[model samples]
Each structure stands twice: as C-alpha cells, then as structure tokens.
Target: MKIISPCRVHMGLIDMNGSVGRIDGGIGATLDYPNCEIVGKESNEIEIEFSSSISNKTAEEDLKALYNRMYTSANNILNKIGQTGISLKLKEVIPAHTGLGSGTQVSLSTGKLTSSIYGYNLDAYSIAQLTGRGGTSGIGVSGFEYGGFIVDGGHTFGRNAEKIDYKPSSASKNVKTAPLLFRHNFDWDVVLTIPKIPVEEQVADKKEVDIFKKFCPVPEIDVNRFCRLVLMKMMPAIIENNMKSFGECINEIQGLGFKGAEVQLQKSTLKNLLIHLQNISYSGLSSFGPTIYSLGDKKEIIEYSNEFFDREGLEGDIIISKGNNTGYKLI
Candidate 1:
C-alpha cells in the first residue's frame, strides 16, 4: 500500500507540562503555518531513502543522527507490528527541521503507512499507542488521515478499543466502532518562508516538554473551546475574509503559547526582516526559529518576499499557499 499524509501546523500550541491526567489537562493549540507532506511506500524489505534540498548538506555532526531518524523511524514501526521482516519506503519535500513539523510528519506518516501495510486491520491510533506519535499534537496524524483545515480532538484514553467497558457485555455482546472524523473549512491564506539553511534545528525540542506524561486536556480546552476558537473565531474570520482579525488571532495564539516559557522563540536574522516587513500585513514566525512567515498575503507576498530578501541579502524561498483543507496525497 502506498499512503501519503500531509503535515499540519499548530497556529498556537500550549504544552501541558504533563499536568492533567491521561484525560484531564488544559489544552492550548493553534495553527501556526499551513502544512507539510508525508509519503510512504510499503516494501518487501526494509529500505528507506529521503531527499530534500538540505539532506545532502546536513551538518557533519547531525548527519549520523539524521540518518537514524529516517532509518530507525522505519525500523521501529515495522518492528512493533511484527512486520520487522518487511521494509518500508518514504519520501518528502519538506526539509528537515526549519520550524516545520518535519519529524512529526515523518513519524506519523510512517505509522500510518505501517498500519496500512497491516491491511487497515489496525487503526492509526493503535499504532500511535505503540509509537506515541499523536499523544498531544494529533493534528498531524489527523492530517495524515485526511488533510484539511481541521479541528483535531487529540485522543483521550480508551480501553484497547474494546467496547467491553462501554456497557456491560451481557451474554457476549458485540461491540464495534465507527469513529466519525470531521474536517472543517478554514479560509485563511499563509505565506511560507523557506529559509536558506537546510535541516534547521528546533529551538524548543531541546527543552523536551513531557507535560502530556502528567496531564490531559479534559480540564483545559475541549471540543467546545475548540469550536469557539476554531469555528467561532478562526472559521468566521476565514469565511468572512477578515484578514486583520485573523492575523490578530494568530498572534494572540502565539503569545499564549509562550506563557509556559518553555516554547522558546530565539532571535533570528529575520529580526530586522520582520521589522522591515512589519509595514506589510499578515506574517509571523512559525513554531520556533527559522522560517518566519508573512501569513495570508496571497496577492503578491511572493514578489514582496523576493524584494525584501534581495534588500537584506538573505536568500529565501516563497511558498504562496493557503490552509490545505485536505490531507496528504501522492502523485
């Protein structure tokens, strides 16, 4: 089976620091940028190949570890499913690091493909239970399921997917599930800044927020809050075409994310870049470090970026795209 999944962006993400139980905690998340892609191929033998503008030129020290990320990620999935005997293949256009959710996309995509290899007899969440890919940020996993402007309710605890607990299994009753997956329309457009450097490191990944190990979102944000922020605020802005309010909401989300102080936004050369471009509307840095964005400037953000990059003598790539209201696909 050849499965492809798109990457997802968290406009505003709040790490719980593992405060709530497996089912209870305050949840804070927002769509940062637009998306990423995950492409997978199930093979007879375990072989992995990856290519990006920077893959061939990663830092010498990071080379070995990078290879392991690609290799071990595959081995780990195949091995966990008793498919260690089989090898899987994956390819991506999103470069490693660079403030893009490359790693999450890669791992969850691998998990999805591995599950598909199991003939869908197993669900992605089950694989997640084994691999821990969608513990907090299941949006990427949801994106893998079906790309779109989504309000992903990251998983809550469940009993091995066995319905024995749903109701007393009187006289050997049958339990089945048809989990309804939903994706909403998001109207915002975003400008993606592909910085020159390849394999940009994540500033916050180093701090390692294991908050999920301690807390859950049952206490904080839930479907209702998600609906308000996403539907009431985010969706209306996107639909009504309110760019400024949309921009402000995105900015507000980022501010909330920094409250823990664990999500670091180390300064980049873009400091002056952001200052100079501040006059223009719709833009901010995604995640942490590298790839500063000028969101929702569809008409001519590309041309503006070129002129600014030329003026600053900084090389960058401009991706004029909107929220992909669908998931990943392969050509």
Candidate 2:
C-alpha cells in the first residue's frame, strides 16, 4: 500500500487566552507541493528506507528525526493491531521544523500505511489519536483527512477540560483532534519561501515548550480581535474568492494575539523579509517560521524571494503551490 499526503501552512492559532471556554483554534490550508509519500508492505521484520529523492537532499538531523517518527509510528500501529513487522520506504518528504507541520504529516502517513498493510482499517483521526498528534492544531490532521482551507473549533479549556494550558501540538500529545468547523476549496496561489537558518534558530522540542510557557495566555482583547478577523473577514473572503481581503487578513494576523508573539521571536532577517513581502502582497509567517508565505502574484513573490535570498546570501527553497482540495491519496 502507498499513501501520499499533502503538507499544510498553519496560518495562526486563535484564542490562546481560552477565556471563552475554548483554546487552540486554528486556521490553515493544505498545500499541493512538498508532500509526504510512503509505501509499505508486510515483512518478517520492521524495516525503513528513504528513496534517493529524499536522502540526497535532506539534512542529516532531519533524516534522523524522520526515521525515528516512521519507526515509532509503525510500531504504535502494529502494536495496536496485534501485528508486527513492515517494510516501509519513504519516497518524498516535507522539510521539518520550518513551520510547515512536517511532524504530523510524517507520523500520520506512517501510521496509516502500517495499519493498511496489516489489514486494520484506520482513519486519519484514529491514526492521529493512536500516534498522539493534533494536540494543539487540527490543520495537520484535518489536512491529511480532508484538504483545502480549514478552520478547527479547538478544544475545551479551563480545569478538567480537553486542554488546560497553552501548548504546541508536539507538547500537547494525546489531545483529541479539534472539531473542524469550516472547510472550503481555497483557490488562491500560495508562494512559500523557506529560508535556511541555523539549527538553534529552529524552534522545537524544549525551545518550543519554553516559548509557550513564557508567552501564553495572550491578552483577551487580542484574542477577540483575532476571532473577529477570521470569522468575518477571512472566511468571507475565501467563500467569495476575494484574494485581496484574504491577503489583508493574513497580513493583519501577523500582528495579533499569539501570532504577534511568535513573530516577535523571529530573527531580524526573517522579520525584514516578511515586511518586504507584505509590501508586495498579503504575506504572513507560517507558525514559528523561517517559512514566509504570500498570497496572489506567484511570479512576483517568487522573484522577490529569490532576490531577497541572494541579497542576504541565504539559501533555501521557494515553492509555488495551490490548495489541495482532496486530501491524501492511496494506491
């Protein structure tokens, strides 16, 4: 069995305050380019291999982490079904820790393939639950299940709630995938610029936890404004295919609520790049990103991103992608 899953761009987290009884609401869209593809078959013993397509270009640390996730995810599903051993091959991958939600995609894809190979049918949510993903954001899980523009309702907050504190998905394991409130086929062009940065600047593991601890419980007023923008402005623009309004919302989101804090933590070069892109079109940093995305004018955005990278003597990937209306495919 083979599974191919699309990657996603997490626009932002909404309602970090959780004052209104929910927390960790998310808005994002699935992307067509830079996806995860894996094939699995029954084997006497567990095994994993990455195709030359990925092995040649992927970083050593990223390859190690991806290998571990595949091994662990396969084991989790195998244990669940009272089965063991599968030969897995990774044909392609989304780069990790660039604010593109690569971890969730890797885990879910591995789990799903393992379950299918063992004749144990499992849905994306079930795989997510078994593999402990979608703790804080539903975009990755939902993106794997049903693609396009998505808005998740988030988890119940306060004492004895689905989530009691503000945390990223990696740190909020075992939390159920949030309820998906809205989904639409997002047709706008998406330009992604992933700038190369040092490992220390890539936020993950303990750094992500500490960042959440230090800058959470964002002001209630900011959360309220964030909600209004999503509900009134962003959603409407998508339904109407208004790129201008949608881009405006993306630009505004960068300076509001939890997203504002996330942007504050970025390096000066990334900050300047975001400002430069905003001047050209509607742009925002995806998650805790060195990955900046702009909506509309794909040609102009890609050209400028290349120029910016050249001027700064930085290196990375620039991709032109569109929303994936269909989720993962099986063959």
RMSD of each: 8.3, 1.1
Tens-digit lDDT string for candidate 2 (36-63): 9999899977899999978898888889
Give candidate 2 misplaced runs (Cα > 4 Å).
Answer: none
TM-score, cand. 1 vs. native:
0.67
Stretches off by above 4 angstroms in model 1 are 14-44, 51-63, 152-182, 196-204, 208-232, 239-241, 257-264, 275-278
RMSD of 1: 8.3
Model 1's alpha-carbon lDDT is 0.48
Q: Could you say which candidate leads in TM-score?
A: 2
Worst 10-residue lDDT window for candidate 2 reads 112-121
Candidate No. with top lDDT: 2
User: For residue 124, what is the lDDT in candidate 2?
Assistant: 93
